[model samples]
Target: MYGIYIYNSKNRNITIGTKEEKKFSLDIYQIYTHDPLEELLNEFREGQFSTTLTSKQKHMLLKMVRKNRPAFAIDEEPLGKIRGHDIELYLDVEIPYPPMLRRPPYPESLESRKESEKHINELLEMDVIRKIRHKEIV
Candidate 1:
């Protein structure tokens, strides 16, 4: 996807509810695309953006997708997870009893059932899901 952003710089001290702010700058322009482009020229022309792109410029943008393809998510060697040691997740709940152990059900349709089974198998293969010995968490 192609994106464009424009900013207008203004300085002001803090108060509530006015255009001026110390926290953020004014957003003048923003453009982004997530879908396949059928006709590049017509799509770019339709928006209410302050600026416009020529057909040649639009064509050049699409070339980025062909020239630079991303590595798949399955390629975990380069993109290891970003779990910071300083941060932790905490769950706060006031429950009367323990959390329920529920295996509600998978979809009944044949295709859905097959997809569900495939997902389980993939997780098992990846070790994303695994067996572990558990004790009471007093």
Candidate 2:
């Protein structure tokens, strides 16, 4: 993925909720692909953003991407994860607990089940979540 942001600034002292309220307007352009850097450069040459971006701005954007190309490369494999921090779940209720019915797991194909297990394993390996072993009451 490649991204470029351009900020438009009118003046230094900007007031709130005034005409200059929208002083800092930002233009963000992004391209998501696994193509090589050379191909991406060709895309820019072919005027991918000719209408919105000036030649100089486009050149600078492409130059920045080329300079930091290694950081953009990502693995093709998909993994389930929440990147930043641990997530907390809280249930806020004032009513008393009520009886609930249990249902069996949804039916799925062999391939689908394998895919689910693979994602679960990945999450477990990352310590993002833990597996719970439940005993059914008959």
Candidate 3:
């Protein structure tokens, strides 16, 4: 006889007639939801998810799996849990952008400009810089 059984706790020993079977098992955790994709999409559409995420996160979910970042918990509340009647979902939500990566400071010092000019000159000498010039009509 073949059978599949789910136990609330870990079970190690099973006795059948004169034979005793011992098996080591680990806990199986899963996220359950009636409509996981739809729910995740709804949450994203409503702007209920975080935006912070690394390139890895984007590559994993968005590029690899073709799923939106907000749809998964990786870009928002990662440890958040959503409970349903039949299923429980675990999320690792993350914010989309890091504060530091946004709104970079503008260069305000002449020294900075000089350093940039030096670099540009070096690139130009190496023929690695292409200058686009517009002619003025007199």
| Most accurate candidate by lDDT | 2
Instruction: Give the runs in model 3 whose Cα sits over 4 Å from its true position.
Output: 1-105, 134-138
Q: Candidate 1 lDDT, tens digit per residue, 32-135? A: 65545445435444433225876565577645533442321324433323223334445464545344634454448988889988877767665445545677
- lDDT, candidates in the order shown: 0.48, 0.58, 0.50
In candidate 1, position 134 carries an lDDT of 70
TM-score of each: 0.26, 0.32, 0.21
RMSD of each: 23.8, 22.6, 20.3
Candidates ranked, most accurate by TM-score first = 2, 1, 3
Which prediction has more favorable TM-score, 2 or 3? 2
The number of the candidate with the highest TM-score is: 2
lDDT digits (tens) for residues 91-128 of candidate 2: 56434643332355679999999999998987677665
Which stretches of model 2 miss by more than 4 angstroms? 1-40, 43-47, 66-104, 119-138
**Candidate 3 local accuracy as lDDT?**
0.50
TM-score of 2: 0.32
